[model samples]
Target chain A: MQFNANTKMAEVIHVNYLLLPILNRFDIQLGFGDKTISEICAEQKINVDFFLEIINSFHDYNYFPQDRLQSFPLDLIIEYILKSHYYYINIKVPLIETTIITLSTSSDKLQNKYVQLIVKFFQEYKEELINHITDEEIRVYPYMLSVDKALRSGNIGKELVEKVKKNPIRIIESEHTNIEDKLFDLKNIIIKYLPPATNYSLSNTLLIELFRLEQDLNDHARIEDKVLVPKVEMLENQILQKL
Target chain B: MNLKKTIICVKSPIIYRGIAYCIHSIQPGIELEHYNNIDKLLKDDNHEDKLFILDINLLPDPAFYFLERMFVNFQDLTLIALSERFLSDKLAVYFRGSILITDSEEIVKNKLKNIIDTGKEINRTNRKNSAISEREQEVLRLVAFGFTNKQISDQLYISTHTVITHRKNISSKLGIKTIAGLTVYAIINGIISPDEML
Candidate 1:
């Protein structure tokens, strides 16, 4: 179901618990009692329209209104993007690593070996993921924000313009595919090759976390590719035309 | 008919042990004659209706011609390609089925069961014109179970390129492109066990 400003915030969570982490991105805590999304946004001083669009898109993948999202100030989108990156590096990555460590310690010898291989695979993936995230943080996101700033101020700095021409967002776009492919391979290696674990709950938890991270990352990429990149591209083009 | 005799022509003791263990696990009473060389395997005269698991890597140069000649001489021989890696398509065409040294005991048993149940030669022409050949079905099952292209190729004695081609054909024929979608189809079609999902 497509949630709107009128939809009860609690009802949204009841329908899809996956939205819980996403809600946390906006600092929307669980104590929201009987508050409609509009009411909560007013209470929290969050943008009701932006909240509705983000939640609706997250709730239903097909519900993304790209034009509407892009129309919002790029700052709002980038803030969420930065928060997601923070979540991945600080929360999700550590959580998965600890889960692997826990499962490996508790599993039998056969499953332990599998978990060790998984650790190696995940370590490589983690390095690549962090590198990708660092590239975005250190380079791509800055370029995007600079472009947005230049477009808004109606004045592009000479150095910033040169940087824009040198580093297009397409490089980051291709890296997204590589990181995603590695994640997919990691999941399959565990699913297809691993011997069944004696500590089933721990193994299942690892699987669940991997799947959740994958889905969330894909959604995050969609925002970057479909909404963020195009908006930045438009800004870049406008600035280039002025030049 | 019960599988009365089998021959394994592999040099590596480890691979030989693995194949022997799987065979014994499946049919404990069956006879398995091991030969470390092609000449030794060829010298044996009783080849009718016998299962032969031969390692293509161990075979001398021009393995394809030798394999074809062996098949022609023993029309009833059931040849299963045993390889550490995928065999070239030219060499793979002679086998009734194939198994990898890296294959799980269950996978080895399944391939053996399939070949024994069908008891048919690898008719290349018929497979080429068919909607989805038996080999393609094997590829589909492995693909559904989340085996990568290289893994599927290694297990099936086909090259990675061949695996990709089969995957494309399978996707087109079944109208399913994603691995998850193909997996659901496999579960529905009984290509793999639902219990394996756990």
Candidate 2:
């Protein structure tokens, strides 16, 4: 999807009905009095470029404009990104979970077992996903912000920054990838091996929702892994160069 | 299946405490024991199928005397040697009788979960007949046949790092370390015929 500031929200959603949730998330209303996305975002006091970056990223992951991201205020970016995390944790997850329980309990005997397994798999997946973002929110991001603060203040020692660099972050990357893996497992179970023919609409709805989530979730992590990590490393280097 | 208890034998209370903390982090609420003097603890305690973790660097008794003595007494127990240094010849022989050769603390921290998992596997196997995953068993079979880590990775179509991981799992699951020891295990398990090796 070639998303731009002037593109109408109606036109975008026409192609992908799943994008409604993401648009509604930022209070970017559908009937924007016929306003363009950029105009509507500006009206809401949202950072238009940041919104574009996120939406475009949500649109196409491989098209992350790393160059445009440098001028983006990280504080604003992080806040907006953190809100996306809350949207998953507080809203989407519980909604999906309740849907699973409601749908699963209504299944017949043979199907109930499979439905139970699906619910179990999703519960475990939800836990891991929460932990993944929670670690980033509670630990990694705060550390990066501190590094940013230290750099901006011109006082954090080279030794400390070096120490942070020396410490391996592959653990986080592995865990972050683990979250993706659990979803893939769920997807395989749903698409390939799901029990035959009961509540087809409910089952299809769950799969579609999962398909949408997988994209949004991976994009979220891509932003964190690709954009934030490298940007912080750049800040560290800039500080080193100054010294 | 009964949950297995883990015992750590080391001289320094400080280091023992550190190892205990790391183990606890990997697995919470398992039975764990620490003793400067293993013989005394063995005599006093009645744990069947206990898994022992020993740091040979700190073994006050000559490695052979203590390791052999403990093996004789705790026939059902599995042993894992934890240390930073390579084993001395005598110590190496003793390690061959045990279940694992744990690397330094840093490597241990990274591989700790796999270590504990393997120990539990060995413990539950009713002494020396633990079932490894098919892939791990294949790695073990190749390793026993004297392939290098890289060669095994190539043969298995997996990365050298994955081969190393499987090797670690193999060591933890079966206390035999040397190529000779592993060959004996492989033959006993019918992983490969003696005629095939010859």
Candidate 3:
């Protein structure tokens, strides 16, 4: 879809379903009717550039440039990425875990162990995800911020620049694969091994949650792996060249 | 004054005459070559800075294709699209820095004057060689498909940091900043097709 100032909010959603959660973060209600994206954002006082860049990136990442991205606050991208992380950690994971817990309490001895296994698998996945995000939030994101700061000033210390340039982007990369393995394993376990007789409805619900998480987790990993890692590497390289 | 490096493609004799007249009036000593067919104009590749003006209303498809092909292969050229009415809705998304002008000679003269006055050719040479890298193009292809940075990294087997570096460099080189803008550029530059975009 060719998004412009006059593009309707409803039209964008119609084009890309993935953009729904992105809009929801900005308090953009679905009942916006035929209002143009620019108009709705104006009323809401949202940064239209930031909103457009995020949606467009979600719709298609190739459209954005560094300077254009620089026009909007980098904090917004960081914030958006962080929010996605929060959604997975606080909301999506817990919802799935809660369903697993409910399944455990149901009056079926045979399914109880299976339910416990699923719940335990999810907890492990959650721990890994939390640890990965926390690492990014604590170590990597701050480094990016400092890079942004140095970029703006046009002067960076040799050691500081080299530190970022050499920052362990590779270290965090393996974690994504590990997470993918666990998610994939848990999904296969549920589909192939879980006995669905007693907790048929519950298992179905669990299956649905798992499927959704699987998709969401893929997107999450993509954001981290494709988007975040590349950005930092770029910043690091820029600093290195300057040094 | 020397019309050694410009190509104008317009099928209409009357419109072509008007443009010629306008160019002569703007700079009386200036020289020009006109072609009724876009194919003839693109027949030879010039290494010097060149300006190409296409009448969008006449054979619009080939005109756009010609422009994009020139952009990808030829390197240093300024492209102009002249139409009787605004055809931006259908064509603007594919505009890769091409100046869009209506069929008014006065408007064309004004726009062309700006290009000439700024000495546009001198700068284009510097930009031609700094084309987006192969890796950046790969990042661009995935980005157009809406893969988040991390997803792109996983698929390409590159670190997310490397993907970002490519993206930043891609944006800077293309002079486009939004994902949608980059998407349009990819299509225009033949990096990706319109059908490929979702």
What is candidate 2's local distance difference test score?
0.65
**DockQ values, each candidate:** 0.05, 0.02, 0.01
DockQ, Cα level, model 3? 0.01
lDDT of 1 by residue, B129-186 (tens): 3345556767987886788899888777679999999999987776556565565455
Top of the candidates by TM-score: 1
Considering chain A alone, what is the TM-score of candidate 2?
0.87
Query: Which tens-of-lDDT digit does each residue in A1-243 have in candidate 3?
Result: 557778999999889876787787787888988899899999999888777866776577456444555445556678877887777788888888888888889837745744655665577678887887788789778877787778779979776755764554655455433456566556655664345647678778888877777766665566556566677667667777775
DockQ of structure 2: 0.02
Model 1, docking class: incorrect
| lDDT measured at residue B134 in model 1 versus the true structure, 0 to 100 | 55
How many angstroms is residue B52 displaced in model 2 relative to the true structure, after the best TM-score fit?
42
- The per-residue C-alpha lDDT of model 2 at residue A87 equals 83
True contacts kept of 3: 0.00
Q: In angstroms, how far off is A99's CA in candidate 2?
A: 2.4
> TM-score for all predictions?
0.61, 0.53, 0.48
Return the clash pairs for model 1, or none.
none
